[model samples]
Target: MRSRSTLLDGRCTISRCLPLSLYRARTTRPLENHHGQTPVRKRLNSDMPASTVSSRHFYQNETLLDFVARSSRPVSLRQLAFFGMKLTNDKIIQSANFVRQELPTRMAHRIHDMQSLPYSIVRNNHISYVYELYYHSFNTIRRFPVIKTVDDNDRFCDVLRELLAHHTAVIPHLVMGVIECSDLIDSKRMDNFMESMLRSRISRRVFTEQHIALTDAFLKDPNFKPTEQVGQVFFQCSAADVVRQCDTLARSLTQSSHEGIPIPELVFEGDVNTKFACVASHLRYMVGEILRNTFEASAERYQAMGNPPAPVLVTIIDAPQHVTFRFSDRAGGIPPEIIPYLWSFVKGPRSMIRHHNFKQVPVLEAIVEELETFVAVARGQRKRISSLTSLTTRSPTLRLGMGLPMCKIYAEFWGGKIAVKSIEGFGCDVFLHISKLGNESRFVQMNNI
Candidate 1:
């Protein structure tokens, strides 16, 4: 037995020692404080019976279950999902659905208690914890030596009860942690995605500016001849044709300036002009955004460490089903902690370079514009997954913070679907689907900014 302090309503009372596994580490320190007080930490393991006087005291005063039972609370979907995941089987989910369908009543106070927590918090923390716990329990059940059969034990039920008790006991703390996670994820994803978009927009602006400059040179110089140009002069067109094409098939792009950067083997299949509509430019932008982010991230690291430029490998596979692009940078690899937040639009661990002068590109402005394109596509009401033709695509762009979300929105906007897979130490792959619209370039004018 070890000596311990008792707690009630967040206050602690000094008392004679007792032996408890949870309190064994505190034996060396005196129980009494400067004011002759004892600070009792929350206890995890105690051998006392449920009927003991001290146990009763602790249950009545320290446990949050009582507080929740007495209050009017609201339940959230996330908690319900967590509970569902922790429960014995499909029955829990069914029971929750049944409970949810009914109005709040004294008999269903637990549901009400659950509803009291904010939604965002639950996804970030509570859901994550519940998932983690469920996964751990799943592993334990699988590996345990004593298991006679899957149905022989009440292991799942017991763990679920423990989870519920923890939530009820420290509802506020759990809720707060969940909310913090939501905020962090949201902010991070948004920042990273937005940064990627801005970079693409900047690149597009550079391309457009160069195109205009070339046109002016062609007009002013006697030596400059468009017909004699070395490369494929489009294999076609007039300035008017180019402008009309820009309005329709022009692809907004981000690509490596270095010709040596190898393209990796990533591709998609489907009627490109049909599914994406007039959004081909935007789609390309999304793809470019992903590649640019990977390339830039790698390049910046090399620059920081004073290493020579390391080439990135990128590839594209196009078929009747979809268009896919894959990009790989020599910059080590993405860190585990940042993976979940990789495609978010929030600022990352690495900060962007800021210019002291006003003339430089406004990174934030570009991000907002890129994000706007996605928001526009997502906010479209006519879109749905049912409208898309089945297809598969792979690209680094799909991993951009807003890329997948936008791809989902755009695909679904026109009735399509999206999927993604990634190996943290290796790379990421994304898939998108949109109904074939038969090559009609769909364009919506941006409101004059």
Candidate 2:
């Protein structure tokens, strides 16, 4: 039995105040705010039973449960392009409706997952902010009327545009929350939560951006012809070309960061003209991150050893069902200490260092490109550029240790994979396998929560 003063004091932590089981019990009272007032609760949907509501988590609502009960519709590259080719008013409305219904489902699952986290983690200010953001977005989207007319769709798009902008800060805030709660949760649990959150986020963005692109295309020209690209999906994305472009950008960025350091040359090999059907921006980010790592490592190694930097070998292999990009670097391979946690988002010895540095730029404006830039391109102001190029231009040395994990997520999103083979004292090889079939569905791991 804790005293009122003890419970309301800011010095008391959730875990310190109550046992985990009791904290999670349905009968637990809602936590009081600094003003010692119970938060106002929304009216539960008439269909929902009182037993289903938990006072411990205020955001658990009927809309969230309804959406969470439904499964998400997955789209492939071919399916996405096929729908966008001959867009009409009806098709636009159909697309708008899909987005309207799908977004809330995805957001609901995320919020549910957040609610399922430990009470101590949920109490984190950053995590609480994210939870509120999702809840707000989820409610706002679910309340929107079904799209029937073009005017309705226009209004829906406006809402999406605003939500998308608001979500630009989600990644950074989530990262900070995890960092702050690192001691409260195990590495595996944190990784699983972050992975599920990010993958779902990617899926949501894909659906939203694709529909927006389709609407913009139809508005620009009623008789618009679909070429290689239909929104984010590219029917014949050039792998070798993306590599060369990323190489150039990575070299320039590395040189800028490590001034006067000898940067390694990228030696292209194998199929240099390989083309495939995939999302070009996702591929660009993976390749650019790999190239940047190799270049920076090679430069540092050579400079320290008083020797010239060695060239990096990039081999592109195009198979019948898949495309593979292999990046071989001679720079001293990944340090053995951090290799085990290479693909972890919140683990490893450098996590604290990364946390300290990330605090300097608390809010990451964008993961790939700013929303303004993406919207500008959609509005036909400028041609679309590589995501990595845009990101590096904004922050050349933006290394928060999320590159590899994010790359892995992007690869797995489309049923592809990323792997690394490292020799502690010699060199390393990074393999990026992409599904060329364009029929494989998005890879969504089940949330343990």
Candidate 3:
């Protein structure tokens, strides 16, 4: 192998004793031979292990950061130097540029495309870029002398905004999309007529299909007796089961809705159900909203591509230590510019804010009529419209900006926290963490839905 200098602790020196395997690794660039195949370059890290890549867990529990982290694996200096030289390959560089350009185009062609352009690459690319950036940041940028400035804070904010626009937006979207998708799939829509429809449902087939005892509990307990006495109900949903269901639904929907877009990848650690083991109706609604946004976003991307909806992956970690969830997507990741204000209802990209999906409606008259009705309602309470009835009739559009905030509130209320991360041109990840139920197991538990 040819001799070369290696950078160690910010210093460089020629070293001949460096491992030859490292040189061989460098010679190949990306160490393709180590695994006997071209390493997959992932754009995002779904909340599962990379070894568990599957279309079933496509978007449910993935994040762009995980992809970045996985991509940043340590390698020998010879490999790094060789890879750096290989990066000069027109084809390698072109592939990167191709992603940068094609992603934005795909995004712009769809609503909220700006948010999904980043998380498309496979894992290796994500890590490589992160590693390269780390090297550059330390060896190049850090070497510059620092100077204090009165406007430093403001400057930082600008940089932060820029970074978010360029890096973090998709992370949360991936997270939000995954958890929400799983939860939504797990949700069984029970309408007002459900009771009347199921009144005669005590067939032997039903008994054989489900846990009869659990069914009896729901039928007997006033809390879930399908009566008016139940103000609001709560339940626990299994994360793994939810992932399985979402996969089924996404596949069904994709086959029926659009042509066929490839689904995103998903990966995660631990368990999802153990976090939100017990769930409330409000939390379900919140989860629905988040999933609705995710689905809508994915659907829009599919439409833009003139392809069908793709598969999605959702993971719920029912870990004993911390119950968590991961959501990932194949539509790349969110744009960096919108990360800070992603859930803030602040103005989005001008193109999105001005693009009215309901453009055909007469806005002026509609607003005036809406305001007049609002004032009329505010002046007095109506006796006829029950709160529940009104809630159903007046439910806000699922795409409204309230989803994340509502999810945060519900997650926090349930003794958990939510977080997100993304890669600029790859994908995104969202994580929800809740206090674990110490020594608790739902293995034999049955949900009396």
Best by TM-score: 2
Model 1, which residues run further than 4 Å from truth?
1-277, 304-310, 343-408, 411-435, 438-449
1-449: candidate 1 lDDT, tens digit per residue: 32232222112221222223222222234354232322222222222222222222212222233333443233221222222222232433343222222212221232222222232322243333432332222222223233232232233223223322332212222223333343434454434333332332222222222222232343345254343221111211122222223222112221222234332222223222222222333344344445455554444455455455454444443345433434444555666765664444333442121111111211122121333243334346332211011111112133223344444434443334555555554445444433333321122111000
Q: Which tens-of-lDDT digit does each residue in 147-241 have in candidate 2?
A: 89998898777678766656655777788879888777787988999989888888787778788878888888978888888877788889988
TM-score of each: 0.28, 0.82, 0.34
The root-mean-square deviation over C-alpha atoms between each candidate and the true structure, in angstroms, is 23.9, 7.8, 26.0
Ten-residue region with minimum lDDT total, candidate 1: 440-449
Q: What value does the lDDT take at residue 407 in candidate 3?
A: 58
Give lDDT per model, in order. 0.31, 0.72, 0.32
lDDT of 1: 0.31
Rank by TM-score (best first) = 2, 3, 1
Winner by lDDT: 2
lDDT of 3 at 159: 26
**Residue lDDT tens for model 3, 1-449:** 33323222212211222234332312223333232322222212222332221121223222222222231121121221122222222323332232222222221212111112222211223222322322222222112223133232223223222322222222222223322222222112211111111111111111111212222333345243322111122234455554444443333333333345444333434544342334333334443444444555565666666555444456666555566667765555667876764643223443233223222111211011222232235446443421111111111221334356445544554356677676764455667665433222222111111
RMSD of 3: 26.0
